[model samples]
Target: MKDADFSDLLLIRKGEKDLTLGGGDSALAPVVSIGEWEARKEALKELYMLTLGQAPYHDIDPDLEIISEEDCGAYLRRKLMYNTGADERISAYMLLPKGLKGKVPAVLCIHPTTSMGKEQTIGNDPSSNGHDRAYALHLVEQGFITFAFDLMSAGERCFSGLKDFDTAPFYEKYPKWSSRGKDLWDVSQALDVVQSMPEVDAEKIGSIGHSQGGGITIHAMAVEPRIKAGVSSCGEWPMRISKNPFNAARTGWWVGRPLLRPFCVTGKEFPVQMHELLAMAAPNAIMNISALNDCKYTVEEKEFTGEAFRNMEENARKIYQLYGRPEAFKSITHLNGHSFLKEQRKAAYEFLKQHLFK
Candidate 1:
């Protein structure tokens, strides 16, 4: 009846119409058995690939040149550079235990969005303080070989000399390219590097990451089967984007901007719901760590985020159960804000150890 009430009505109507255009069709169709789950997973995987756009080309035979090597007591760190595509050269650090005779389990330690990037994860950066504790070094201490690589626009790849990464330039230069696709391809190729190592047990390779690093861990698991196990700490939750545009834009960067509907016409709903992505990772061991009072999302928002993750876990577990390995999917939540704290870190390590080593 009043002006405020009329405005609310308009907002609600707009939201409803947008949802319809985004294909409000739910991804949570009932699955009766493993065969049905398998078909669903295949369909979801195909849709996800389409949503992410095309990934760059890969050349796995590039000569990985080790430019420097250092002995870090528990492990040997070798800094290496190689080409992932025709023009995409990657710089990464490989940590190998001192006396690993046979092939050992390996982890692709993805780095968070930091200026130091891979150095922070590999324990070579002193400026990170306590926030960016070297988790990759910890993995090496736990007797697993590890590889930490710089994501695009981070570490050495931030070649623009700008203070912050601006993906707008990239999109302008290559209109059809997807940032998420390029990143997915890059990390997938990193798996190739892990498998190529003589000391790495390729079949037992896993990945762990914090924040954006954690977000990629989930994405990598859904798309990259080479990752046998994965741990995502305070990463992006599947259903957060459509509802929370602010957080999505804050975390997603330029390319992620379009995911907020009405902002970009093409950025409607994903062909499959976020839960389906988890389902796509079926049979593989995956662990999601959530923080109850994360600073990123408000208290009310966290409640929704937590519920979304729980729902995803529930639906994804159906697929895992169909495989007769329900324990493959696990989730943990703590009161601490967004972080991969000591207790959380330990749980991730034990998870990987259990699945990949035990």
Candidate 2:
């Protein structure tokens, strides 16, 4: 269907006047007090859920099944699968640190936009160069039980013979549900699996991701309260400020949400923006890692410079401060271009450790 043919129904239930673009200087309605923020948090989550489409039923039990186990020196890696819905099951790797004396902190490791999926997070992908992308392995070595899983369109979950993300089958099966919704649900279920484990401290769970995984990290933390702390590396930017906000490769067709097409075509302001989404994670520890040169011209020439990251951070910080937990929200920027290297990985790990362990 052409972009213009998509429905123009308002994605958010609240009127546009009540919403703000975030940041100190935005023209939209700014959240001023903690009471105001408390009333708006649920609405903002509902608005984001509207953009993502219908969520899957969560009442079904995750029938956990173990497929295999391997000894990896510092940790034991177990390949497993569990039900996220009545019919849907997702593959994951659960890394448990050896010689555990008691229940330990756990982290959900999310991979970037690679076909390697959970494999890259565990250092099993040769194409990942080194241990930089193997953050799950790194975390396990640091004594945190780590769970890494394949997103719907990546790794083992990708369609056979497809090297890149394929959303056709997903849309065909769940015509009304968006891929983003499925992802968010899967993440929440993954947390359920982690909390069920006897070796894990249920209350100490956190999440970390890079690129696409990073964006999912923010979304998951906003809606999934089980995620006590989160680290997102170069994962997001304000959609309204993006050059091609609704292009296919950006947040348009890939997200499987056609409702955004009307706004893109008419150049209308989005009722919901990324900064508002970030604010929804208030009181919970969240660290945003951005790169100054993370630019891309695939759909349209646009650069996610450090300046843009700071603007979004500044806006989200206002909400965290209102909660009296200003230090819970942290951000860092590097000169690297669209990449998460060793230095950034160390900082992310340190942040997660401080919040989850200390």
Candidate 3:
């Protein structure tokens, strides 16, 4: 047999169409006025709700149960589990400062890419990953009440007997359900639990997360307006991609078969680019934290992301400006990699302090 003549499929390297969600002529522009902003916000929220699966229609009881409590110097730490939905329970750590009186600002400290889940946020995991620093403790020490919870597929909630990174099964099981949507709803439910606390100032709630949690933070703020301020660290910054599966080298771990498959349909893209998602958090004090060398993007991809970040900032700024709070939206880029480094952490804490506390 002649060495297999293989010009049919392997030799022709052209793809069906380019990934053109929001690029060139289709780029989104800043909305013109407050009225326009309001209209756009409502439409975008509804669109995302549909895309990510509508928020559970029924009420979630938020069954708050404190399993354990401990006095840890500057704060009191309590381990609790609460129902974020009819049957969805979230295990969390609630930190309350020792001597504070009256209601105080509260923050939801979301964990990064870790199987240990809420443990990383509360300093309980004891893992060496730099991203797992005890951010909740830092917030409590700074006099802010804080809550940290296991994201849906992480920690105690990983009922599938698989690692947290293995999230596709959950998505596959529920056709209309998405990990992102469930995570977003959990954030809202977390806010509900925080507000119910007499020591928490319901009007002064903020959220901060890194990596996986960081991406969720953006979506959470977009869907839940009650999040008064948010800080997203090195999450979902890349909006445009080459459409070629080979581009996996640049898309990182999120674009593979099954994980983000729902959003990765051929020739089509998410109804809105992520920058629009950033804009969805407009009029609220929000900050985007980026690592110049975050492991998620290649050098060229980083340049593309830098430009995109600037564009997103400008778009979101326009909304904040229309609301007469131009200073409320900010983006900070650092030299760190994908992990939640000290600089980003400090910046997040300061941003939350400026908006939620002041």
Candidate 4:
């Protein structure tokens, strides 16, 4: 039998900076994957092209269904949201068809922009101009089901005055030990819910997220097999070793917070890129949306970011194409910046309709 270890299968070659992909100085630029490279290096080249990364790390913890709330007339509420125990009790919202009697399609909604603590704060911002509720509600209206809720630190469990928490419990329990493991927890727990439901077609479940949620979506898909498709917004900054967005490699998502030096990450254990995370969705359709004028970063940098994410998009297609379906992945651009656009939404629904409903 062939040894499982791929050590002899490939090596990580370090090329000069000037020999970078496309010879572009911008981290977002793409490079041709010279087939002669080693396995990880080839994977890295493919990952760099897509602009997303593989999982930061994979956990061995088994999936467990630990929470279920029956209060919503909306989604079937549950918490196997976080597949791994890295995060905890990540509250999830499952919106099903109003008059549904049986199985239906479902989408796991992820929130990209988040704060220090309190995972549920994402739900309230629906009143904001770019809030995701409109899309979630729109999904409901389209005879589809969606689950949208606060991630670790945004909505009800908020850290810096964000979520809709019941402070009475805080006063009753004293020190609340959260903030650290809430995000990943919700994702795994939600995964359990998706897999266990008879009304949900396990093969058709998908995910869509913006900002911090988008980043989480990338992470979730990297580790979960149920996610059939993903639409990522501005959280496409993981691959760039520069400033702004989720490129924690530079300034970290929490501005002013200490930046993460590669060496400082648990004795140099490398985290996967966002593109690699996207690749975990192989054989599934993915739509990456970005705008050239996003104000989050400087103008020139935005273009570079776009090119980099496109590399990820194309690479994902290449992999899925190996499964013999080149149309399983895609990328789109808007003239605007940072925010998810209507066109992207339209395209997303269409992709879902094609892959899931068809």
Candidate 5:
């Protein structure tokens, strides 16, 4: 679709019901009935794809390659690489539980914004400090086949002598595409890798992440129906409320896109809101784990406060209620500031298990 066509969908219309009511103040489109929601869902998906730059077709075979393998007692850990694009490969680590009786549920464990990338999720990088970030390892011990991979510009994908979070090289390679798109595309590809495994129950795949990874989990769950359930930790924030919505200047590129840059510069409202994005995953199981003190510094400034996060969850719950599966949508908050503590990790695993395992 043309940039103008996509931008037009984002324009707020008159005479629509307001879902945000007293929530974090933002212009959101009204939620319609189930039949209308089905059509609107597809439209919203298209708009999001346009905003992130449509991902190229992945027609090539994912020629999977195993670099090395080691036995870690309860599970076998393998360092592997697979094709995302015909010319592009993603480095990953897969933990397969030993002596599986049959096909079991699998989880795509996305790591936070650390230089260690997938290594942190598997507890292989001690220098990357955090509490129980080795969630991939923990899940594997719980008998779930877990796959963790390096996002673009992270882990082994990082350029020589550069940090993992750098996006300059990525933009240089694909100036029109946003880092967010690449991340989400890679995740869909990772799902391909995990689903192909003999020990994995392809129908029971889920995703979990914290911070940047958390944000990716949310987007991935929205677009990829293969993700039966997901846990997004401390990644709830409205793009319009961002100081530089849609990364207008291309600095700190996360959710910014070229098509939305004009709106950012003009200070105009985007057609969709964060709550609406979360709502797009209705009838499917998804949980938002927000920290009460998340973005503490900014909350002190009255920007993206915890109240806003709860408001987004509340508004999104309306869609779940419409689907008659309100229990499938859940959220929990803690006093910890931005960090995913051990207790939160436990809760996340339980939620995923409840949804994906049974």
Candidate 6:
């Protein structure tokens, strides 16, 4: 994003390490939901089930495959050769930066509303979600290796959204062969690939996404410990009561149905919100990016994210106080709406540099 403005960010090199874990201003006091205090355990349990699917990550065959390769900037780009069978394989562009000399700290880039594999991820493309900001690509330029894959129903996942994310003919012979809900499982598999890579520093890994990608990143980070940090851009971490496409995601239905509902759904009350669950990811660096003009992003929406983050920081401080870096769980909002404006992206970059690099 050539037009991106980093002038406002208080840039600081990573120096102090906050190893302290659990409870601080970032955390909230555990509370029972107004409607259902007992709260069902299955919600989180379902979350565990939600991020993964029956699709085995160790299998020889891959639903999403790489189709092409290119060189952009200082990174090696590979087009994902993938076909989940719901449609064609998800069309995605993977970038491997030249600066990443060896087992490098890695990050996963998730896109907003459009398909995955955006040429703009690195900031050169103009046709796609033109923000002049590419978090995935920006991270690579910063010296940390990163991964960006198309989710089912997105980019290479399929032209269709989750309803038809995969196109395997077997789905033709089967029932609900392609539920984008299973895409999270697809992401889980993607993690396996990232983890398996010899050049990726598996221990210092992270995931960052915008909007829709933000939703997935939060879920993935919560369930997968391999990711040490998570950044949600224009993503709703607060779990507002609004009907966000991200909140009503098929994955939510899939996980909450039968298994997490009734017990965890506490309709009138919530034992905890999605943010509370995320708080469990304390001590791990976290940054939430929100835009004001992006109409889809609301005050209520951010409140949920902010309150939850605040609560989590409190939870984190109870155990470890040195990293007492209670400020880790934080949020920054742009006056603009639903979209990630220039300032928003800059905040994200600064946050990552502070935590991941440090």
Best by TM-score: 2
Per residue, candidate 3 scores C-alpha lDDT tens digits across 247-341 of: 22123333222333445555555555556677678778888888656544566556655665565566566667778988888888765677677
User: Cα RMSD (Å) per model?
Assistant: 7.4, 6.6, 9.6, 10.3, 6.9, 10.8
lDDT of 1 at 241: 38
Report the lDDT of model 2 for residue 56: 47
lDDT of 5: 0.76
Candidate 3 TM-score, C-alpha based: 0.82
The Cα error of candidate 1 at residue 235, in Å, is: 1.1
**lDDT score of residue 37 within candidate 5:** 71
Question: Cα deviation of 246 in candidate 4 (Å)?
Answer: 7.7
What is the total number of backbone clashes in candidate 4? 63
Backbone clash count, each prediction separately: 0, 1, 0, 63, 2, 59
Ranking by TM-score: 2, 5, 1, 3, 6, 4
Instruction: Give the per-residue lDDT of model 2 (tens digit) for 1-358.
Output: 1111111111222334534544243233445677667667787777777777665465778899999999988889998889987787888999999999999999999998888889999998777454677889999999999999998878778877755567777777886777778888888889889999999999999999998889889988888888999999888865655667664223422554656667778888666666766777778899988766554523222233544565666667777888888888988887666778988989899999999997
C-alpha positional error of residue 8 in candidate 6 after TM-score superposition, expressed in Å? 35
lDDT of each: 0.72, 0.77, 0.71, 0.53, 0.76, 0.54
Model 5's TM-score against the true structure = 0.85
Candidate 1 global lDDT = 0.72
Q: Considering summed lDDT, which 10 consecutive residues are worst modelled in model 3?
A: 1-10
Minimum summed lDDT over a 10-residue window in model 6 is located at 1-10
Tell me which residue pairs clash in candidate 1: none
Worst 10 residues of 5 by lDDT: 1-10
TM-score of 4: 0.64
How far in Å is the alpha carbon of 141 misplaced in model 2?
0.9
State how far residue 214 of model 5 sits from its true place (Å). Answer: 0.5
Off by over 4 Å in 4: 1-91, 112-133, 160-182, 244-260, 263-271, 299-306
After superposition, the stretches of candidate 2 with alpha carbons farther than 4 Å from their true spots are 1-30, 128-130, 247-253, 297-304
